[model samples]
Target: MTDDARARGLTRMQEVYGWKPPEIDGAFFATTVDHLFAEIWSRPGLSDRDRRLLLLGALTAQGRMETAEIQIHGALHNKEMSEEQLREIALFLCHYVGWPNGTRLDTAISTVTARVRDGGEPRMRRLK
Candidate 1:
């Protein structure tokens, strides 16, 4: 990837996550910045908010709450989504993604929403 793309990706990541990659895993970090953020995320068709919502659904469906939490927090932090919207998505997913998966995500969403309303920092910053 070009230096500019890499830089922009890193900036975006930091803006969303409020943290940087550790130096120990530079290659993995570089690929995430260069490919995932710069290449894939920079694509034109979807808005950032749309991507965030889609990612929330995909992550919840896949039962990846750890990662989903990050995306959820990002969505709220960026004001791309609201708690009611997330709750609606969870309810909507129940028919398609199953009740168990939807409930799992709803639990996580509740936790994050409470944190935000209580003026606490997101757990994503503490994630490795």
Candidate 2:
């Protein structure tokens, strides 16, 4: 990938996820930044808000709460979604995804929302 593409993706990734991988994983991280963020995410078919919502649903359904937390924070940070919108999404998914999955999603959303309300910085850490 071009330097410009990688740099742009890195900036966007940092804006959304709050952190980037270390140099130790530079190759993999570069690929992620170059292809996933720059190429795929830049596609015009979906708005950033729409992409975030899709990711939120998939992560929630898979019980990937940690990753989902970061996405939730991004949604709120970017004003792509409101607290009420998130709450409604959780409630609406309950019937389709089942109570257990929905409950976990709700808990994750509540935790992130509370942290944001308290003026705490978004939690950041290395991805596994």
Candidate 3:
């Protein structure tokens, strides 16, 4: 992270966790966030499908439910994956991973679906 990211994270951390700092180690956090993810993950070469899959696997493995939900919405926003694709992924994880993980996916899907139902903004495009 540059000074900007550090400063921003600092302020957000203070706001969220009362300045205790995230459980993450500080030294590698900057490099990983600022360079590895920000630089590479933003590249156009990786399709939305690929990014969504990556995020689903990573977040599920790490048990990061909230971020995983955001990624589910983001995949939709990017026009990468469909609602069906998300359900399938989660369902697969359910069988291989466990029922609890499957539940996480269901929860995320419900949250996103409700957001759309509540007039969040429709972006689903039917495949012709």
Candidate 4:
């Protein structure tokens, strides 16, 4: 909405995702940066690490491996989680989220962990 919101959103994106998102134009993108990141993610009480864990669980439960991989990368890049912890999360979630979803989440974790360990840069999706 405002420049201030955009600035805060961009800053918060870096804080959360460990990288800068490309400035994109679209209602969805606007809402994501202006509202979701600026307002929701920047909220007090919940640390970024806590929020990330919750998001990871939700993403894994929904079988959203693509986004899960992104979050996994963020967690590792930000040093909020270790590869061991990520694997444990996938294992622990298997019973609750189902074996299939857990397997997908594990794959994502492995992919992101390998990339990060190899010193590869995070892959960014083109937001429309």
**Which model scores highest in TM-score?**
4
> In model 1, which regions exceed 4 Å deviation?
15-24, 125-128
- Cα displacement (angstroms), candidate 4, residue 8, comes to 0.3
Instruction: After superposing candidate 4 on the true structure, give the runs of residues whose Cα lies further than 4 Å from its correct spot.
Output: none
- Residue pairs clashing in model 1 are none
| Worst ten in a row by lDDT for model 2 | 16-25
Ranking 3 against 4 by TM-score, winner: 4
Per-residue lDDT of model 2, residues 20-81, tens digit only: 53443567777888888877787889988889888888887888888788888888888888
TM-score of each: 0.84, 0.86, 0.61, 0.96
Worst lDDT 10-window in candidate 4? 119-128
| Predicted structure 2: lDDT | 0.80
* Residue 68, candidate 3: C-alpha displacement in angstroms: 0.6
| Residue clash pairs of candidate 3 | 1-30
Ranking by lDDT: 4, 2, 1, 3
Total clashes in model 4, counting residue pairs 3 or more apart in sequence or in different chains: 0
- lDDT against the true structure, per candidate, is 0.79, 0.80, 0.64, 0.90
**1-128: candidate 1 lDDT, tens digit per residue:** 68898888877776655456444335766788878887778789998888887888898889988888777877888888888898889999888889999999999999888887898766643222
Positional deviation of 108 in candidate 2, in angstroms? Answer: 0.9
Report the C-alpha displacement of residue 70, candidate 1, in angstroms: 0.6
Winner on TM-score (1 vs 3): 1
For model 4, name the residue pairs that clash: none
Candidate 3: lDDT of 78? Answer: 58
